[model samples]
Target: MQKVTLYTKLNCHLCQDVYMMLMELTLETPLEIDLVDITHAHNSHIRAKYTDRIPVLARPQSEVELEWPFTMADIRAFLSDPAPDS
Candidate 1:
């Protein structure tokens, strides 16, 4: 299964939207999502990397990122595309 990482923060409306969209997508797509809270890991370098980009979706193996304000079509396309070689 494809691995999806969501970099987000609590009480973020955009993050909430993304979460809902991801839940809906999970109903049909076969992707495993890992939700990370930047606030809880504030000192971590990963948190710094996505500080201003909460709600970002990343396919670590593919090094692909889908930032917030993304549409369902964008999510669908990302899921359909082949993961990039490591």
Candidate 2:
């Protein structure tokens, strides 16, 4: 299984859309996604880091993140390959 963190926020349409896309992708691909609400007070630093980059998907071990404007095909590629430093 590929484990990843999804940075998001409340009331964000894009974040919600990405969350659903991840869920749908799980039906076909093996993905363990951890949802993090960047708007939370405890995640101030995370919020600062991804404030303008919500709906970011991060592969923890490699520290690779795929920002928005991505597609299902892109996600498949991201899972199967090491992403360029981002």
In order, the Cα lDDT scores of the candidates are 0.84, 0.84
Estimate the TM-score of every prediction: 0.86, 0.85
Per-residue lDDT of 29-70 in model 2, one digit per residue for the tens? 788888998888495788799999888988876777899989
Candidate 2 yields a Cα-based lDDT of 0.84
Q: Could you tell me how far off, in angstroms, the CA of residue 31 lies in candidate 1 after the best superposition?
A: 1.9
lDDT of 1 by residue, 1-86 (tens): 67788898889989888888888988887778888899898578987888888889988767789887789899888877787725
Model 2 residue 45 lDDT score: 82
